[model samples]
Target chain A: MDTVCSINNLARCLVEGGFSPDLANLLTLLGGVVLVATIPLVTVIFLIWIERKVAARVQDRLGPNRVGPVGLLQTVADALKMLTKEDITPTGADKFIYNLAPVIAFATVILMWAVVPFTPLHIGADVGIGVLYFMAVASIGTVKIMVAGWSSNNKYALLGAFRTIAQLLSYEVPLVLSLLIPVMLAGTMSLQGITEAQGGMWYLFIAPVAAFLFYVANLAETGRAPFDLLEAESEIIAGYNIEYSGFKWGMFMASEFLHAFTAALFFAIIFMGGWWGPFVQEVPLLGALYLVGKTAIVYVFGLVLRATVPRVRIDQLMALNWKFLVPLAIANVLVIAFLIQVLKALGLMPVPGADIIAHLPMTVVMLLGNLVIIAVAMQVLRNQGREEKMAQEARMAARQQRVVKEVRTPAGAPVGD
Target chain B: MLEFNASTVAFVVMTLFILGGALGVVTTRNLIHATLYLILSLFGVAGYFVLLSAPFLAAVQVLVYIGAIAILIVFAVMLTRSMTRMSEILNGQWLLSAIVGAGLFLLLVIGVILPTWGNGGLLDATVSAPSQVVIDTVDLGKALVDRNGFVLPFEVASLLLTAAMIGAIVIARDDTE
Candidate 1:
């Protein structure tokens, strides 16, 4: 389902609707943004409701059931609670950043919402550099988290902020590199352009390994389990958001939900053919509806992952990324490039033959090669963990030997010792 | 000169943002304030870029400048010892610089407006001529991956990134090592 909605599909849909493709594209972009913001906001509210209901089911208890037929109004009631809660400011905190953090976090993710070209026509600003736009803006969320953490002036908050920053910085690299494959395959940075190129076949079919890596990297980015070591409540005590309360916290929560949606949206754009519903592609209204429905379903996949998975350990997490993802990403880039060249030469791929690369089949072969890289990376990281453990044991032994030497005469010197 | 439209109004405001930010950068005594203002200024510049239909450039400006460089400057400032000073933002060099800045601003404004007085005809004729080189993103992208695609300069950009990475490692690592 996560296939590219080619430009032909987009144009066909637009023309059928009696609109110019370019003009439809502009309108689509504007609508896509509004959809991006509104859909996520609505999704977040819905998710919050679903989360409580799920928690109730897990605990074997009935959840909020009084207001508006089986407690559907429960989430609304929660919002009202937040609205009435008194705003608080710590005596010794940076007022500027403290206030700005939530706003920035809430806002930066929306910029990301715009770059994704939905149904090819109802897109955001389909600039030539859409992917770059996504990459550039996504990281700004770090500053927001950092500011939120720093302004809190609490130790736990500080460490949480640091961890969040570190997590984002590390995962962002692999995420970018993995996504680069689709770009390399499509040979364009624009979201719409890439989708259009893939009209022949979804990059996922050819670049399965890249797609897998992208999903994992993105899951980590969205702070889902197996990667969400930053905000482990048992470890960091609410991470960088410990100090936030009331509406400020609501904004942060809203941003997180939005992030989750956008992450899913990007993944859907890459993997699921965005707006490629059955008769929806050629039909006008049905296509738009299908696109939104598909996107939301993609979003739900992440939410389910969050509900199901458990967070991984921090050191283990960092090691998995540094020793595994980075190498795989670098290798992936090289293999794709070489494969593209070979495919061009062999007159197989439709790529300009004069470049004289190999064929499309060769490109597919190179992409398949990633599974081997993933297996190797997994093995390498497992070995790396063993080495780190051995090193740690050696240090502990040396410290124990020092204590033994220093304590030789202490037996008779002091009972307390 | 030419009167403004909605976009032109936006452009003027954006220009002010960059100018004010630039002014803040040079004039402000508090480096942190300067950094904040710099973020503001770059943000304005980005708005200007968007207005000019170069969304990519604007996005890059925000990403590289506001996200990376400005944050780095703030981080560096925090590491320095003089961060605690709470005083008036301006100091000794500000007064002199302000006078010079004002004069330069006046001169530029005059230079721009002066062209409208009959002499603007020369500028209009020059502007009306058809541009030989088409400037667009696709053209730029073609220039990028074009085998002969300005590869030399692109390589230089990569080289700069490498140097910066090395510099970051040196500056950020604990010196005790």
Candidate 2:
């Protein structure tokens, strides 16, 4: 089963076919690096087109229908334009650092793909610390944004970068905390191992709240709507990348597009039983298709959210992360850990078996726990809403009374009245 | 004569990153630039951890140190507008600090070299062993939680972290009154 997509098997086959060992190994490594790099670059072209189409549809307008079938070549044309446009460097800006930031931003996301398991056989490294690698590489992005903002020598860019770092840092707590559920449940940090462990059932059913927290945190991490203060187009005029032009600006856009999709991909892999479908284990290429299919679905969901939701105030963003998501993530982790331990003790924990139906009992228990957590969260949200409503009504009533008193006092009214 | 092997090349490149970044950190007048150099140095340290077959440590190094701590340091640096463009790279304590730094470097070099020199053959034997032992992530996870392992220390560390977090929040909060 593991042999189907494995680069090791391919290398061995090459060796058996009379290729030198060193050459085979080198070729395999090179092929993997190339594949990982190309997948995102190629996909971003399509992703941008899809994002525009989706956003347009949601806004009740006709998207690109020119250049190719339904404007498919729009991104390609954009890429061409970006390539030909003038590259400008602002005077007094730190030129080297400013130039380096976009490359860093683009490269960091690609580095994350190095750990992504596309199919059973198609992993780059399959490192023991795969999940952590994703987090670590993603974190490097903050530095890149900082460099971009700081080196721009512009106040708005600096403010945008500041907001970005604050939002990213605040949300990272819950992001990491939510990731612990899968790590704990699978008992492995390896993404492939997590995927394989979910052979019986996806972690989404087992830990819905954790998955939800991860999704929200990821949205914030990617600076998507409700958390898009990083750019907040109307306010900061493109935030960190305002000074960048041409393909340098295009690279930042591409990285943002790639980052959003990457978050969805990670969500699919960790929670949605990545590459687990009919005959995927037998035919590994099918696994790749399944992964892509799931990632697209998740990606579209994120796009919908982006197009629909209003951006949150920076204070609200911070409060949501620190007060709500962080605590909820922590509580969810504790609940899951305790439940797992208790289930194991009672010998009620289901084995990772081929039969997906056998997972129902365990799933039901987890679902119940998730329900409790969700209920608590709803209660908190309802309370906050009620308090706001009451405060608004009180202010309205006080204003009305003041208006009536003013009318009663003839001196307070206009002399003509 | 140039004898090229993978590890040696990697080691040499990583050493350059470490040394160059450390040099940049100390000599750069711009605080933000210094912080970026510090990240580069930290990244090199993480690479060393990977070379040492401690990938978990390397990940932790990146996740905690580079990700959280370095970012926090940069955040702090950026917040103070005046600190970003420093007029001086060296202060009054430069000479004394240089001497102390040199002394510390010498001591560390000697400490590392003396033991390595004594155990060079043993180290080579271990390195050339057919099956090099590796501590996997599972073992680390288990060790952290097991009663006879590091459970006590681990819990205490968490408690300390929580306390520190609370203290930070309290100190940072604005006084409404």
Residue A114 lDDT in model 1?
68
The residue-by-residue lDDT of candidate 2 on A255-302, one tens digit each, is 999999999999999999898899987888898899999999999999
Chain B TM-score for each model?
A: 0.69, 0.82
Q: Candidate 2: what's its TM-score on chain B?
A: 0.82
Model 1, stretches more than 4 Å misplaced?
A: A1-36, A53-71, A153-155, A288-298, A308-317, A350-363, A385-417, B23-33, B81-85, B88-134, B145-149, B174-177
Q: iRMS of each prediction in angstroms?
A: 1.7, 0.8
Number of the predicted model whose lDDT against the real structure is largest: 2
Residue A259 lDDT in candidate 2: 97
lDDT digits (tens) for residues A1-417 of candidate 1: 333455436545665678976677666555555766775567667766665676576567787788778788877888889999987877677788788889998788777876767664666567777887888788677778767877787888878877776777788778888888887777778887776665445566667767777778877777776677667889988888888889898888777777777787777677665655556456745645655676678666665666677788878788778877777888888877777777668766764222213334554576567666667767877897899899999999999999997888676576762
Off by over 4 Å in 2: A1-20, A402-417, B1-4, B119-134, B170-177
Candidate 2's error at A122, in angstroms? 1.8
